[model samples]
Structure formats: structure tokens, C-alpha cells
Target: MAQPLQPAEPPKARAFEAIVDHIERQVLSGELNPGEHLPGERELVTAFQVSRSSVREAMRVLESNGMIASRPGDPRGAVILAPTSGPLQKVISRLAQASASSLADLLIYRMTLESSANSLAATRRTEADLLQLEKAMARMRAARAQGQEAFSKADLDFHDVVANASGHALLRISAEAVRDSIEQLIAASIEQSPDDHALMQRTIDHHDQVFQAIRDQDAHLAEHLARSSLFEYYGHLLAKDEQIALSALASFGSNTR
Candidate 1:
């Protein structure tokens, strides 16, 4: 017996998404550039052959992703924004807060990414890059007497400098996202440590060693020091098995570099 063929399901309606994709392609293709103004909503609606609502929705999505900025009462439509890691930071931070497992994963990912960034920074850093690193270290040292909050900010700044020195956009963005995701956890750990001053001093000393390795252009040492510092600071938070796995990966990254 031949059964009647089932009717195929209709495709999903995603007009706004299509519009968003079109704009993104244009921007990526360099047809639209940062600081350039997008066409007015009506123009986009006509060009995309979609409704005004669809065009508006697409613009909102783009704005949320840091791709464009819209001001109220501006007849010039939205301004194209230079891409930034802000959206990545927000997404990573949200995911890390979603579960203990996610936080653990974030830490492992950061260890790998940061070690690579340190290695690259060591090999590629310029005089300006070294100066930035030194300034960040100075801030860390100065903040030691102030308290954990100040020190933590300086520590983050130092890592930012190291990531920037790598001159890899993806690495810099990923490092920033991971750092933001774990920042609160790091601060809480510092606050709960029995000897805050000792911990702070240890951090400053670790930074100094990493700074020296970068200055001397010792890629392997810089990578090893960065990984070791991270593991030393955060190993207590991980389960025994996870800690062992992360340590192994850190060794692999340092050795392979």
C-alpha cells in the first residue's frame, strides 16, 4: 500500500535575520566602513525589500552586537561602529556565570590563550609595548599598599598590555573575554585569602618575572611563567582531576612554544 506523502513543513520566516546578514556582509566586504552612516530605515527597507519593522529589528540586533550605533532623532540612520570585543566579553561572562562547569572551562581556555599571548608578546613586543607593560607593573606595585581592589585592576591592566603586545586580534579578544568572565571569581578569592598582603606581593613578583621574560624576548620562559602564575593562583578552585588536566595542557603549551 502506498501511503500519501506528508506535506513538507514551511521554512521559517527570518526576514530580519536576512537583513542583518546582508549588512554584515557589506561591512565585512569593506563596502561599509567604521564611522560610515547606514542608509535611513526607509532606504534599508526598500533595498532589502522587507518591511520597516524588519529593518528596525535588524538594526537593533546589529547595535546589540556592537556593530552599529543609532541615536534617536538622527536622520542619518545608524553609524557603523568599529568592531570590538565588548560583545564577546558579555557573552563569555554570561556563560561563565551560568554554571560551575562553564567557569572551569573558561579557566582552562584562558590558560591556553594567555600562555600563547605571552609567548607571542615576548617575541614580538616593541619598545612601546615594553613601556606599556612596565607602566602596568608600576601600577600593580603602587596599588599593593592600597588594597586588593586596586591591585586587581592593575593586574588586569597588565594582562591587557601583554595580550595587546601579541598583536593578534583574536588572541587579544579571547583573552579579554576570559579575563572578564573570571574577574569576579579572582577578586573573591583574593578577598578570602588568609594573607591578602602576601598574596598581593606574590602576584607583583610573578608579574615582574613575566615582564622580564618579555623584555628579554625569552618566549619559552614568558609562556611558562604566565601559565605557572595562573595555575598557582587558581588551582585551588578546580577539582583535583580538572586541575591535573589543566596543568598538563599548560605544560604542553609552554613546551610546544
Candidate 2:
């Protein structure tokens, strides 16, 4: 008796990936440039021979990474956008919310990355970086005269400049990731009340000290200040959390009585 030959197994289905692969190839191959509009959903469906839903999902993935943007009712609205770190912040925030990671983990991550950035920035900062840092510091002072909310943005910008001046894109990326991910928690945890004027002044003073360390090219002092700032900030957050828990317990005991 003769044995029959069987056909080889078919390749695994990559239904979702087909659209991704096509878009990525076009972008990499220079067919898609910044500000160029991509084909609409119906056109993509016909061109890729994939379902409309698949194309839409792929577009969303691209959108999240700042590859393209779609607006309502315009045929050419699905245009390419120049990618920026803002999209990275959005992605990081979404991931944090979805994963339910704790604030402590985020602070730990920031400490590790920012300490290294501070050490590097001490040696690597340019004159332009120093000017930028000074501008941000001035903005912080002006914001304080206006209000806390005004100051908060300048405070955040100062940290961003420091990270950027480190001359390490990865450090900038990591710092933004942690900060964006825990932004909501930070907002809820840290308060800047009028009564806390002295605390705010101390924060500004410490920032100046760190800035001077970097300006002087004192890497060791820069690193120490960066790490100490993070540790102190994390301690404040933990203390607040404990205070809330104790308040809740006290309320519960009163209710039971």
C-alpha cells in the first residue's frame, strides 16, 4: 500500500497585524510623510482587502503613538502628525490607569531615572540649556505671584527641561513616563495652600541649589539633590496616604459607637 502526502500546515492568521504592517511599511518607505493625509477608512478597506473594523483599529494604534490624527467630516482629515513626547505621555497615562500601578512604584522609577539624568546633565548641559532653565525658573517665580495653578505648570516645565538637558532621550522618555502615569495621583496627593508658603519657598530654594550644582558641573551634588528631592516627595505622599487611612478608620469607629 502507498502512503498519501499531506499538505503543510497553513500559516497562523494575522488578521489584526495585516493593516499595521501595511501602514508601517508605507511610513518607513517614505510614502507617508508628515502632514500627508492617509486614505480614508473605506479606501483603506478596499486597498488592504481587510475589514473596515480592522483598519479602524490599526488607525487607533497609530493615533495613540502620534502617527496620524482623524477629525470629523473632512475627507482629508486623517492627516499625519509630527510625533512628540506628548503622545508618549498619553500612552503612559492610559497604561497606568489600566494596570492600576501604585504611586510608590512610579516614584521609585522616577528616582532611578532622574538621578542619572541629573548626574549627566551636570556635565552635558549647554549654554542654551542653562538659559532655558533660567527662563523656567523665572516663570515659576511669576506664577507664584499669580497663583498655585499658574506655578504648577512652570514647576513641571523646570523638571522637563532638566530631563531634556541630560542629553539622553531615554532618560527624558522614562521621566515623562513616570510623571505622566502618576500625574493624577500627584495632583490629588500634593497640595499648595496659602498656609504652606514656607514649604513652597523651601521647594524653590532646593530647586535653585540643584540648578547651581548642575551649573557648576558638580555631578555628585546634582545626583544627591535629585535623589533627595524624590525621596522627600515620596515621603510626603506616603504620609498623606497614611493620614487618609487613619481618618477613615476614625470615622468607622465613630459610626460603630
Candidate 3:
């Protein structure tokens, strides 16, 4: 009656995914530290009872996901890597460019991230952080005649300082990831603008407000300003309906509007 156990089902877990998950769990759980070595390929192959190719595939996933450094034929095995935003940024950039809806999605996510980062910066910034912000702003002003490339770098530097000042690593990383994802779109707008100098000047002026909010430790105001500034800079690219939806997210009150 058991029908010969219905011919035992194959294991649902894929061999390579098992290997990847095992290592990732160890890394996340702190059993494996950054710069620590993963077991040798031959050893992993034996331990997992999987083929050498499975082990190599696992290594590829780990490296691509920013979890390790692997090189074929390296006797040292794969070294654990410190966390980074690079992989996340790549994924976001890919998705943002995939469709108009995705573009809107990324813009909203970016605005939310910047608002939170600015709020945190207001509450958490150290004197050193403010100094960095000031330096970045000064670079922005000086880069006026240096062209969009330099000004863009300076502008990014200012945001980077705010992200760093937030004192939240994941927040900083995610904000950077999202910012970088849509940077190309923003850059293209700047490049095509008839009055790029006026555009940069307006940006500098808005950033001055942000810098003052952080200096004054005005968290809500800082958050509101951050979102508003981003909306003004990029909202035109979105459809009118999308812009309307975002305006609510961007404004704190009529004052910000």
C-alpha cells in the first residue's frame, strides 16, 4: 500500500545555494570576521558533499554580493570582505533604468533616504562632521567655474558628509546606493540645461540652507529641506501625476512648499 514510498523526492535545496547560505550565515553571525579566510576549495567540496564546481559557483555569488574576495587558484582561499554599497548600487541602477515606473520608485526611495539622513545629521553631527560639510560646500562654490563635473563631485561630497554624519552605517550605505543609482539621470539633466550656472547656483543656495539646518540642529527642518531640495532638482523629470504624489512626501508643511 505505501506504493514503494512514492519514489523519494529529490532534495529541494540546490547544492550551490546551500554552500552560499552556509557561508553567508557564518559571516553575518560573526562566526566569520572580515578578512578571515574561508575554507579551501577542496575542503569546502568535501565538507558540503558537493562537487568542486558547486563550491566555485558559491564563491562567485559571495564575491558578486560583496561578501568575499575570491580568486581562482588562490591557495589562500577566499577572504571575507567588509561590507559595501557597490553591489546594492549596481542593482538599483539597473532597476531604475528599466522602466518609467521604476524611475519614479527610485526617486521616492532616494528622497526618503535623504530626508532621514539629513534629520540624523542634524541630531548627530559632530564638529568634525560640520567642518567636512563646510569644506564640501566651499568646494561647490569654488567649482562654479570648474564645470559641471567638478561641481557634481563637490555636490556629492556634501551629501556624503551628511550621510556620514548620520552615524548610521546602513542608512549611509543605502542612501549612497540610491543616490548613485539615479545620478546619471540627474547629470544628464544638468548637461542639457540651458542655464547650468543658474542651476548650480540654486543648488548651492539650497545646500546652504541644509548646512544651516544641520548647524542649528534642527532635525525636522533639515529633513523637510532635504526632501524639498531634491524635489525641486529632479521633480521635473517625473510625470505630473508622479510629481504630485511625491510633493506630499517632499513637504513638511506649507512653509516648505
**Candidate achieving the largest TM-score:** 1
Whichever of 2 and 3 has more lDDT, that candidate is: 3
Model 1: per-residue Cα lDDT over 118-224, one tens digit each: 99999999999999998999999899898988988999899889999999979988888787778755666543779888888888888998999999999988888
Candidate 3 error regions (>4 Å):
1-10, 71-74, 93-100, 184-191, 254-257
Alpha carbon lDDT at 102, candidate 2: 62
**Each candidate structure's count of clashing pairs:** 0, 0, 0
lDDT of each: 0.86, 0.73, 0.87
Query: Tell me, what's the RMSD of every candidate?
Result: 3.7, 10.3, 4.3
Once fitted onto the true fold, the runs of candidate 1 whose alpha carbons sit more than 4 angstroms away are: 1-13, 93-100, 184-191, 251-257
Tens digits of lDDT, candidate 3, 152-214: 899988988999999988988898898887776566564466998998999999999999999
Instruction: Arrange candidates, best TM-score first.
Output: 1, 3, 2
- Predicted structure with the largest lDDT when compared to the true one: 3
How do these models rank on lDDT, best leading? 3, 1, 2
Candidate 3 lDDT at 174 equals 91
- Stretches of model 2 off by over 4 angstroms after superposition: 1-13, 22-36, 39-47, 51-53, 82-101, 186-194, 239-257
Model 3 is weakest, by summed lDDT over 10 consecutive residues, at: 184-193
Give the per-residue lDDT of model 2 (tens digit) for 12-101.
Answer: 656557777777788878888888988788888888788878888888888876788888888764888754567767766676666544
TM-score of each: 0.85, 0.72, 0.84
